[model samples]
Target: MSTYFAILTQVGEAKLANAIALGQTLKLKKMGVGDGNGALPIPDRLQKALVHEVRRADLNQLAIDPANASQIIVEQVLPEDVGGWWLREIGIYDEAGDLCAVANCPPSYKPLMVEGSGRTQVVRVVLIVASTAAIELKIDPSVVLATRQYADDKAAGAVMAHEAKANPHPQYLSKIDGEAKIAAAIAALVDSSPETLNTLAELAEALGRDPHFATTIADALALKAPLDSPTFTGTPNAPTIPHGDNSARVVNARALAEATQGRAGVQGLSGANHGASPANKFTVSALAVTMRNPATGQAITKYATGALTADVAVVGANGRDQAAVIAGTASVHLHFIFNPATGVTALLWSASADAPTLPAGFSFFAYATTIRYQGANVI
Candidate 1:
């Protein structure tokens, strides 16, 4: 992630700074806010700032899944030589691309050892001294955690995602949220023998979630050794490529037919007789779209032409004009080759003038069929 800055009001700076210090005290306590969740290892120096400059930093590339990494930055406004109360927590708005409130940010403080001797000891405060810390906030924690939990529904599938990022698994692991996720991490590692797997399972069960995740790992063991073992170099099956569920397709087809029925020119292509190609449908998990439930997740698909369909559409004024002046009932007949994904049925169509005739002596003849034409090295 990259980093940038914005300004804070004087009063706001003071309030935020005090909050930072208070946050440190909380960290020192076992039972504090979020179990000391928001605390950062603050340095001394930039703790007291009359005004603070916030910076935006991207951490997407960090070892921790960028999504799992916490957002924070710290800077000191007060010089180490002169210190009293330290500026720590800072809340800012319309900054860092519209951040509203953040904690343990820049403009905070920590202590430093100025000097020490066998006979004497000297200590000074190290505060957030820079004009800005190295990072900034992205969204609200509620949003972040909610999204994570939502993704966790597909327990093993979601946790093994980094390993199986190419294609995620289905939503079978909804039982694997929270500690179950932690267990998934532990289980996915190499050397996860039955003992280790059982240990993780016991931990997960203790946490109140189901113990099936360990079994999933055990399944992997049968197919291949533990994930990280040198002997186990292979692909992870995840982000499962959702195949066209014919059953679901049929359900959707029925809905489509219902929607098109009793409507003008909206005849929906359907079952055996209508001769519409059986469509391929790839259904994405509802949570894959976002880490949070407040927003929905959507899947995009790319398809190629299939062997069943042969004709393509030639869109223009005239479909049949002998002497190269193409003119037909539909006035057009386009052709193309297709090798579509088994999951989808791409059909080409030749558009017709609903009126049946055109001023240029144009007549519509046939509708064209188009299937996906080619495969691209798609995402």
Candidate 2:
């Protein structure tokens, strides 16, 4: 009898087993063979028969079979004298050289150390294939390890993403809610009445209001009328001057005029006496006068109001002191004298001695003479 061996390293062991069972059934039908024992006898062309079985098996049909589910088997052994001692991968194939199944061992499995020899260490993996024939395969530990690491990293990243989604920051949640509220507010405003919001005040009135701003809005509305309707008719009322800490307002023109009437003059000069009556007296005096004598043709003496012995001395030394002169007749021209001691002066136009009377609107006075006195005698 020929020894038959099969090796399978990883998943899909059941697929090969199912193909083997189907091949046996078909062989029995074609050959009309009887099932004498539970196991079938090994045929001389066993490798060829197993190849035909694998070729006839449908992978898709096998996948639906519950018995075809992947089954993992792990075993450890010290392999010796099989080229390199590291077991990287194992594959199952039919003796006709058809691939059936494959398995990859973790490349991290190190070679076992040999005790007495300096040669390479040994590692082992037992691969069993349910098919009737064995297979040959080679694998690189580095390549297998790299592919596994890549898949594990992808899985870990997915897990991290799922965890992050489950938990979010508090502020992030609040910001999302705030944005939603603002969006709602904007939508409401867009849906509100357009005509009612003609001005900013009207818009504010149409919207929700705060109690704290009620008075402010009232004051603003009060100013709004004057600003909108700024036209003034007739004369404007006078502006009121505010007293200490008082608010200003408009006052009537009459009140303003009465308040300002007598306050127009200088502060200190008001009600002062201007001396408008004659009782506020001033002394009057005569000025000295000099005249030219007609016969001698010289300037006469000047007389001023002061202490003097006689009127003859006022006319200078050549003046005639006629104390015993003849009495002035009606035809004789009498001169009116000036007495400096009494501050009295007179002017004569006629010889009439009727108390030295003057004509209407006439007055006697003296004035300082501008002529120089020349020494001459007068009759």
Q: lDDT winner among the candidates?
A: 2
The deviation in Å at residue 246 for candidate 2 is 99
Tens-digit lDDT track of model 1 for 53-84: 32222211101122323323222122233222
Q: How many residue pairs clash in each candidate?
A: 77, 2
Model 2 weakest 10-residue run by lDDT: 25-34
TM-score for candidate 2: 0.17
lDDT comparing candidate 1 with the true structure: 0.29
Report the lDDT tens digits of candidate 2 across residue range 1-379: 2243233322234444565666631010000111213233332212222212211111110111123323222222222322222333333333333433433333322223353333322222233334323122222233222233336867998988877875545555677787998889877876774867745677667655555577777887765437554766766676545333234555554434324331111111111111332121111222344432222223333344332111222221112123332232313122323443443433332323223333322233212211111222112
Task: Predict model 2's lDDT versus the native.
Answer: 0.32
